[model samples]
Target: MVEDGASYWRRNLLIVWISQFLSLMGFSFSLPFSPFFIRDALGVSADSQVKMYAALATASSALALAVMSPLWGILADRYGRKPMLLRANFAGAIIVALMGMSPNITAFIALRMLQGLFTGTMSAAMTLMACCAPRNRQGLTLGALSAAVYSGDMTGQFIGGLLVEWYGFRQAFLYSGMAIGMSGLLVLLLVREDFQRPAPVIKTAETARNWHFKLGIVLSCLPLYILLMMSAFARSVDGSQFALFVEFLNGGVNEAGAARWTGRAAAAGCIGAMLSGLLIGRLLDYFRPSRVARTAALGAMLAMALIAIVPVHMLGMERVALDIGAFGLYFHDQAAPAVLALVPLRFMMIFFSAGLEPVMNVWLSKITPASQKGIVFGFAVTWRSIGWIFGPLAGGTISMLWGVEAIYVVGPFFFLALVPMIGWVLRKIRSRLES
Candidate 1:
């Protein structure tokens, strides 16, 4: 009976991972090139205005996510994670599809905000997996899920770019929505939850009086939440501006060429993420989470630095080689080399950077009471949303002021700053364990 139960949960987790992957893949299809869509499709002519609108579009969703994640978490704890996951995926599909049909940038931004308010499939999926997976196997489970995410992201960006080039931006969004909807169907049909709600406490005078104290106890995990936020911020700062940065590097290249290169660079980063996910479980089993996080941060910093300075010409031959090898096609462009160079740097950066979130998830799980897992994970999501909100807006503004390459120059410092915070958080966790 015990073995059967374990098997059931494991099966459910597998389904959850698949659903999350599909949903993320769909969402990513439209995200990386949103700025380009706004600029070219929507007739936003000014470069600075396009940058600003892109930032706002990204931030609008994040802002809504920041506000709604905790509430969703609470609901998940009260109801069930499965329901929340379905809700997020279904609503996300609708909103994203609507975004493609939007007549103006303003409508698109509003749809993105709506998407944020309704969607948090990643967090919900994580919560479901964490709750279902055995504690001893959590690291491996999360790592696998992370790998799925990266795989989906990489595939989506590559395919989405192709779709955008061949069909147009609207078709890409439609396809993205269909993918997410398929995920929702998979979850609704296959995933199962045996969640039991906590019994309501009879409010005695003493218990009622101590509510504030109880809340205080829960709030003590603020440092962990902050750490999660910083980790997210550090990683995502370059994401919103990445396509624009690639466009900048393309110099005189045509828009289609620039989009293809951007997709390729992003795909490289996804490959790194997939590898990191495969490896992180072993690292977590052997090393302290803080040590792993610090190493990742340092590696990311170095990779970012390399990306900032590497000459564009270094990658030309390599790009041509890949084109001929992979597709039996030859393309000639001066900027191709520079864009190709970005792939390795982006890969290295993501390879190291990808480990941080899963490690932190493991760490947070260790310290948080099991009963409060939803709330704690919710808090983490809330803070992560805040980071996402800040990263795109800040990155956009920086790109506007100093140029897109400057975002890469400034990105390394964020990781550098994270190194010490990891130590401090580790010390705090150690002290708590000792106490």
Candidate 2:
């Protein structure tokens, strides 16, 4: 049964958080460096084809996720969220393991689609947490969950890269699959739910339900979905091809070195994202959601602009020396290559952009009715999936047409474009508040 106290919510949140940490870590292990896997393992020789194949690998799964999220969400409402979590976790374990055994690019892409079709642990976890968490504390709960995602992803990417460098992509994929399988086991054994399916409605009530659903979605959900989609697009636009860019920077170095640098940069970004989750949720709980989102969007724009110049080592800040006489703050010159500069810039960009997601998530949960949360989140994932589809393709096309440099050039605009939409959301949120 759902208890009306802190312990009840805290217990579920803890389990969900741990589960998410493991699952996301597993996911980050393989997906983040797929481009490297394609180039080095699958033996893709053409730069353009490498970019295109990487995009397809992500896009295929996204397309399938877009089609399936709604159905799985409806099932959650009917059967309960635990089953959905189990489904995603267990299926993810198997499919992700299968990826390690893929023989060629086509097989890898096909497996990616299957992974998307069957796995969506994040959405499952979110809906379940939103349902169980106390209404007033949902922001904190979700924010913490987001932190676990970043923390796990940070760990996974770093380790996965090392594993890839040492063993191969196959071993990394296998280990990641094991991690996800373990997460499912944890959920099954520890998590508890008291979900009651909603009673069926007759024709007249169903008609009213349809009207209310449309009105609710139009008034509250659409803007949040747009913002979520925009976030997905901005984050993934260059993500799939990141290792390729790093390899390019390495002056045609081996994939092992490329994998290591890619892992380092990705791990740094996750750390930034992890820290952002720490502060953004607390602020969102007390501040206007739209205002927080707008600030994050703007911050993300500036950060991306900085990242764009990292190829030049951000004006030679990659190495510096300073000495304080009395302050006891002594520093020495840290000489590093120009390409190493991208790590901190990537971190900053993720930190700023990452805040936008939680803001929107809290906003959506606040407006959604408890009973419809599953269906609503399902569609939300669909919208996010749309962004994933477009983002990979856009990143590939931009990088292919103009060179990898174009990725950093074009990325800031995605966040820049979110500012006006955030204003629109702000007004809607304010109206909801006043009403």
Candidate 3:
């Protein structure tokens, strides 16, 4: 009977992992190219206008998400996590499809806001998995799910780039919607929840007195929340401008070529994230999650600094290949190695950045009562959305003022500054655990 129960939950985890991959992939399909979509498809040709509109689009979605996450989370806790996952997937499909049909930037931004308001597939999925998985394997389970997310995101970026090159930006949204719809279908068919809502409690003098203790628990978790915010901010600060940065690098390349290169770079980062998900997810099972997070943050900080200062040509190597065959057929190929210099650094950054989410999730799962998982995770998502809201806006304005490369130079500082806080939090968590 025990073995059967274990197999049952494991099967659910597999299904949820696949569903997360598809859902995230669908959302990311056109994300990397949104700025270009604004400039080209929306006819916003001015650089400043493009930056402003793109930033607005990014921030608006995050803003709505920030506002709505807590509400949805409470509902998920009261009802069941599966319904929330289904809600997000179905709503995301409709919103993304509508985005493809939008006639102007304003309409597009509105659709994106709706996407944020109704969809939080990641958080919802995480809640479901956390609730269902055995306590001892939370790290591994969440980490595996994280890998799926990165894999999906990487696949989406590459395919989205190709789609944009072939069919234009609008079509990417239609494809994204289709992918999300498939994910929803998978959930409807495969996912099972045995959630039982907590029984209502009667208020007593003792219960009223325990309010302060509950507040203390929330306060104790504040540092983790801050770390989540900083991690998100550091990563996203460069995200809005990354494609533009690639375009800047490829001075002579056509728009399609630049988009392709950007996709390649983004995909490389996602590969790093996938690797991290596998490695770090396991590490969390053995070590203090905060310690792992600290190491990753330091590595990411150094890599971002290097990425900012290093010349692309210096980091690249050249290779030539010659093919000889019958009938005197000979072909020679030369590759510019410098174009790939940032790929490794990007990998390093993403590897570490990827560690933050699952580790943080594991820690939260350990600290918070299971009954409150939905609301607490929702709060974490809110903090992430707040970071997403501000990071892109700040990145956009800075890119406009100091050039796109400047964002990279500024990004490392966000991580660098958070190291001390991380250390302090780790100590507090350890002290509490030991006592």
Candidate 4:
């Protein structure tokens, strides 16, 4: 095992963060424009067709993340995270650039699917950071990385909105590709992988008896994924909701102002997410992990309600009040990881969280019998992905059919249900702790 206070930052971490940041910025540049490309560039005429294309695009990415995340995790474990990050960045950069040249919807979807396959770069970079960072500082380090993720996402969205409007999709895409390619090179130059000592091998029979670990992993993962479903659902609402809200308040503005301010609406979450990412880890160190997680879930519920109940009629400071409330609630989005890190072994927690996320397999590494960890984590993630696969489709369908405001009502209830579920899981975890 790597010793505490090893020179992870001087040697490994800074490089990884820098590379990942650049790559993420690149990825961000393309995100805001994806829907526009699908609808206008791809020649989709109707709202429903645009939605279908959007869903397909998202499904392709989710499918890729769902299928490949575990495989990448396994590979990172065996080989190293830096190499995987390199591959992911290089391939992802190429794929993103290719999205610019796609003449039709078919090619666009294919390129996005291919982009998804390479999307594990962030996962790998995160895994690398976890592996190398000082154990005690895992929360802080991971928090910083979370900030990077949020910042990168926001940067990309803002840039994508601007570039797509100013220079068109092709130029915006080329910019994204260049940004990603540079990140790949930076990784190759900067990140140095120090091999990890193998974890003590546990016998299969004895390992199977570690049921608390098994239960902890399952309970933790299932709820984490449900939270993810809620977030993704909210994310899907961003484009349409921002436009509608702005228009309703501003009196049916054109797409330019809508898109410009829509970028701001989405940008609102980044500040909160970034601050949450930075602070939540420290907060975790102070508070009970379960408490923090539960608070996040509850906060999300309340925020959703605020969004639902507050009409666009609210002006000036009133709108600011709604914004603040929504922002605070959005911070709770990563409660799952904070909750997960509360598990023992701080050194491994970050990797476990990063690896297990998007697929829910970290439970095996963190909580279960080494022998059965893979199987249980796999199963848990399978269930999680099933949730993810349907969440946006179901949420989007309902929002479109009934109204987007309905999501505010429905999403909160779904997220709030997890609070109690997490309590039950924590109780189960406590039982194991007592045992």
Candidate 5:
């Protein structure tokens, strides 16, 4: 049974939340401004050129994330999550700071790639939370984490924009690094890891030949890449057309007005994200996690499709239309939190599966061999990293060739593709377990 919120709010919870909240604030400060930095500060204004640069940065960083995520997961499994947490926090803090020192866009992307390699703070935090929290309350714990993370992100976005407007982009980057570094220091001092038994070693040849093993790994990794692809596609479209959308709203208004409108739309999306965190846990409890996730995907696809079909003029006048559409986007974004509720325990494994750390933990705990947890998670992150590579490239290509609406129209079909694949895998998994 799920525990009451009050009951689940324990000492460990506070520790994890506080540390994550701090780290995330630093991360949030840099996110929105990164694109702007590339576009305005660095002076890369061509649409296709910007898309290519974004893809390069995204793919490179994700590639690094892909390589390191599972390695860290495996190490944490072999040793303890506390060490991983400290490594990720302190190391990531340094990386973020260094990224601020990049002399050019080329250097910035390189530093970001390094950041991806070291950015397992979330993975480690989830591992700690999973070990500390009761099984029934996994969703709630993760939900709180999600809320804190998003709050940090929102705060960062708000402040980063102000800082950029005032002191300039470089100063904003420095400020972000300092904020994250302080949080990393706090984590080093506060977080503790409880030791666990080592994962059993598995023969690579036997696991490779085992169809069930291969199937499970494939199932765990594929959907995640697709989701990444969809998200990248969506974000790129929005990024590419943000100015156009704002101008359209302001009747082809001035640059300043367009900037303000863009900010408003982004803030609306953030608000939607916050609301999703609040409600997604309850929704997951009310339905199967898979169902909740699928529904969210459907809602997202529908919103994108509708946005493509519905005239923008209608959107501005109909407040309810904007509300519903915005809610759909928020719901889509909540897929990870909702699915994490049902993930099996090791917690980090869901990172392999695509729902971030919470769901990854749940899934990993259930299927990962007691002795081979580290290797399994490491491999999983590697496969998911492949998604990071393809997702952005596909998003960029599709948007360029077919237009933004085409990307949305095609995304739902991508989600639909997952249904049969996931169903088949689940059936195979069930049979293997029952046998």
Candidate 6:
């Protein structure tokens, strides 16, 4: 018989929550401001070139992540999820530090690919929590865990902006790397996992079909995979292009000024995501995960479309000034009309789209057989990587051709497409349950 899922779940969940917070904070410190890094540190300065390179940088990391997530997931299943978490943290610590000292753009992009190959503390933590948490409380536990992600990103962006402004990009990266290393140490010392190996199957002629059996796991959940990928794609189209959009709105006049504002805007979105993570968890506990996800997608779609059409100078946003305190430490300029209009929409889009991954995770965990959890979550990461890959490249292409603002115009179509795909997956899930 399987052991009790709740025996050590609460303690383990708390440890994982704290560790992932540190890990993601380290990530956001450098990544959210990479466009500036590419322009300032790596010496690539043409407006269009910066946008393309930034997208390329993001897509490179995602490509490596797409390639390696499944292998890591399989290893997690075989060894233990905690080990995977430790591995991700420690490896990320080294790679990210190196990114700070990169000699050229090529080296930075290469390290990013390595970053994807080694780090995914979030997936590892989620898989561990899913396996350990009590069945009835999984939604609550996972929701709390998702909150860690957004909260950490929020905290990191808030502080990282100031850190970058105060120190330099290199210092921020070094600091973030140290923080990730600390997360690994926490997991190593605190979290405990009582991993039970899958029971061995009888050796028979069916052995030749091993690959086929694993492929079946993916095929059965193809629709869910598609929904997750599409959702990821929708979010990326906006996010991967945001830093450049900030520069565009401010007319590319000030670097430090743009960085500070970008951080504030990103932090606002994370606030929305943190709220979404918690609220969706509560809603998921009482409602169908699929239904909740659909509602969120609809909200995300509307918000994104509104962002594209909203009046840039409406509601007196120019007069909404920051509270004065740190003279010379912060920018004294008034908020741009476009920037002001987009921030709320950014929060709304993030609030809704942020619900997609966790809701999909909760839904997948519920529907999947226990034995398939590791591989499924791994594949989930892999599929989402496809979105990451296209999202950045697509953003770059749009910004190059039509303009940065046009990226938002095209974002809604992805969400609109996601609606039907999710409904189709829901139908398939119901049919499987009935049968």
TM-score for all models, in order of appearance: 0.92, 0.91, 0.90, 0.75, 0.73, 0.93
Q: List, residue by residue over 243-361, the lDDT tens digit for candidate 3.
A: 88777655523423677767777888899999899899988888877788878888888888877876344433443343546688764533334336666778788887777788788
Model 2, range 9-85, lDDT digits (tens) per residue? 78888988999999999988888889878877899988788889999999999999999998898888778988999
Tell me the tens digit of each residue's lDDT in model 4 across 337-365: 21111111111212222221222112112
RMSD of each: 3.0, 4.6, 4.1, 9.4, 9.0, 2.9
lDDT of 2: 0.83
Error of 2 at 89 (Å): 0.6
Better of 1 and 4 by TM-score: 1
- 1-435 per-residue lDDT for model 6 (tens digits): 222366889899888889988988998888899999998999997878888889999999889998999999888877778899999999999999899998989999999999999998888898888888766677777888888899899888878888888898989999999999999999999998877876666677785476577778768878888888888888898566788777666555453367877887888888998899888877777778878778888999999889778833343344345545575676445666767777788889889988887778877777666556778889999999999989989988899899888988898988888878888888877765334
lDDT of 5 by residue, 18-58 (tens): 78777777776655556556766777877567666766776
Clashes of 5: 16
Please list the C-alpha lDDT of all candidates, in the order they appear. Answer: 0.82, 0.83, 0.81, 0.56, 0.55, 0.83
Off by over 4 Å in 2: 1-7, 200-220, 254-256, 313-336, 433-435
TM for candidate 4 is: 0.75
**What is the Cα-based TM-score of model 2?**
0.91
